[model samples]
Target: MAAIKPKHQRLVLALIALAAILAAGALATWALRNQASYFYVPSEIVANPPDLDRAVRLGGMVEMGSIEMEADGVTIRFVVGDGTARVPVRFKGLAPSLFVEGSGVVAEGKLAKDGTFIADNLLARHDENYVPRELQDMTEHQKDAVISETVGAK
Candidate 1:
């Protein structure tokens, strides 16, 4: 084989480098395909349900009077609802501290064959101005005691 010219050698090297980068990107995307979580609301879930086997994120308000705890204590069932639709969800784990009825939540899990969302994780959504009930309902003397306990009496 004849020797490659300097100009052609640079072009070949550049092409190989470009090909390597493209291959790396494709490989990364393929590897992360299962890790990518798609978010959907209750209305969308009702309109077009996701595959039962794939992981997904369902976000909406926790329907009031729908939360129920099973005998196992950890398994809880609740309905997530947008204004128009609702999806029943079952989760077997500890819920977030702020998770409560009529509050916004995002559950990450798979859709079960029985049309229930089986959540592996739950995230509660709180407003920016949220305050704990203890703090919000505190009397003046209780607030002063807490402040003094926290900052050692200004």
Candidate 2:
């Protein structure tokens, strides 16, 4: 082999290492394909059966008048619907301030053998305006009181 200069040797070694790293990353990306969770609406879930015992995310509006408060205040149960179907869910924790009836929500959980989506986490989707749906129907006096109380804390 011809005598190689130190600088050229180092450059060639670095290039080889970089190429190896890139190939490793591409292989890893391909191997990890399908690791992402699939999200489905209530309608899609109801229409087809998914592989049992897999993680998924369901997003929709909490159905109106479907919230059922258990004997223990912490364990709240409710139903979420995406206009075509409904999914009942159970959550046991302090819900977000935005969690309310008839609001958009995304729940993360696994489907149980009985077909219910057992939520491990609950995230309420609130609009820029944080007013509760119930507050909109309240009289102006009630709305003003709520606003005052909300503002007083800040």
Candidate 3:
């Protein structure tokens, strides 16, 4: 048997390395196939809902007059809406402090057969101009004093 020349040996090694990398990428993708979550808006969800078993994220503004608490108090129901459509979401947990009507929200979970989104997690979004309720009414000077106090204490 003739030994491969250096040039040929290097080429073979490079091809093997590339194959190994591709195999690693394929394995990673396969392993995380179910872990990936797709994002959809209310309009898209209403047009073509996702599979009931597939986890997905639904993002939209929380519609006014649509939030209600269940008898258990922990389960909250709300409607998320885009300008074109709306999706009802049911979440059985403590929502984030910023979660409220008219705010942006991303609910992560699966869609139900009944068309309601069964959320396992809720993420609330606030605008850049957001101010805490306590600070909203404070004057600029008062706000500065409070800020300095908190900073000094920290």
Candidate 4:
């Protein structure tokens, strides 16, 4: 057999390394496929419902007058809407203080056969310009006074 030149040997080794890295990446993606959750708005979910067994994230505004606590007290049911569509959701556990009617929310869970989303986690969404009630309700002079006080204290 003919001996490979030093340059040729290095080229082969580089190719092998690249092939190994690609294989590892493919394996990792396959293993984590189930862990990767996809996000969808209410309209999208209504148009194309996801597999009942696959985990997904549903994001929309909590419809007003749709929130209801079950008899068990812990289980809550609500309808999430995006103006174009609405999805019924059921969750069990304490919700965040920001989880209120007409507020944006993202619920992570799987869809049930009955078309209800079974949320395992709930995340409240706030606007970029969100401010505390005190700050929002305060006059310009009052806000300046509070800011100065905070700075002086520091």
Candidate 5:
């Protein structure tokens, strides 16, 4: 039997390891492709929204005076505002207790064909003090008090 060189054996082993890693990465990516949910702002969705069937996240401030409660009380319609941009949202299920008009929120679900966001999940701060960007300029003491109050109330 011809003797194989040690360096060539090492090179072959390295190549095989690299190939295995690449294969695993590709498989993982393929598995997660359909599970990924993309996040979009109102402006982005207005210009180019993803497929209506695919799940996504829409984050913005709830437009004041645009929120309307249906007679059933379960079907709530409102508009999400990002300053210059806006997107209408319709939620059939119970919204988060913290959700309110003019509050910062993140809605996760799919968009309807008529430009309404059909949200299945909503995340929002119970009070304006809990919203970070709005609390950014507050003093450390003020921030601590807000945190304590929120935590204590909860």
Candidate 6:
């Protein structure tokens, strides 16, 4: 049998290499398909909810007067709204220090069959003007002094 010419051999090897790379990418995608966490606002979740078991992120402002702590002291429920719709969320464990009524929050978890979001984790969103607790009550002059001192300004 005649051996393959150098040109044909290179082409065959290149095709094989391309096929292998594609297969690896396809496998990676398949393995991580269910690991993706989709983000949704309250209105989006209310309009087209995700599957009960699928992990997702819900982001919105915590509705005023919607927070309820369970008797267990560990479970807290709150409503998140985007002005158009609201989603009830149930979270077990201490919430982030910044989480509060009327504050922006992003909850990561799955939806329950009863239409509640079971949050495994919560992230509190702060505004760009966020100030530390210590500096919150400081006057502008005091804040400037503190900043200058901390920054070693003369």
Per-candidate count of clashing residue pairs (backbone under 3 Å): 0, 0, 0, 0, 0, 0
Estimate the lDDT of model 6: 0.81
Local accuracy of candidate 2 as per-residue lDDT tens digits, 41-146: 6777778746668777777778778988899887888987766588888888777887877666778777777878888888887533466657778765775454
For TM-score, candidate 1 versus 5, the one ahead is 1
Candidate 4, residue 98: the lDDT equals 95
Cα lDDT of model 1 by residue, 1-154, tens digit: 3456877988999999999999999988976774443778877887888888878999877887999999999999999876678899999999999798866789999988888999999999753334477875676466434433432321
- TM-score for each predicted model, relative to the true structure: 0.61, 0.60, 0.61, 0.62, 0.58, 0.61
- lDDT (Cα atoms) of all candidates against the true structure: 0.80, 0.73, 0.81, 0.81, 0.77, 0.81
Error of 6 at 108 (Å): 0.5
> Residue 15 of model 2: what lDDT?
100
**Distance (Å) between predicted and true CA of 74, model 3?**
0.5
Residue pairs clashing, model 6: none
| Model 4 stretches astray by more than 4 angstroms | 1-37, 131-154
Once model 1 is optimally superposed onto the true structure by TM-score, how far is the C-alpha of residue 5 displaced, in angstroms? 29
TM-score of 3: 0.61
Q: Candidate 4's residue-wise lDDT over 52-151, tens digit each?
A: 9988999877887999999999999999977678899999998999998866788999999988999999999764444477874676576445433432
Weakest lDDT window of 10 consecutive positions for candidate 5: 145-154
- What does candidate 1 score on TM? 0.61
Candidate 4: clashing pairs of residues:
none
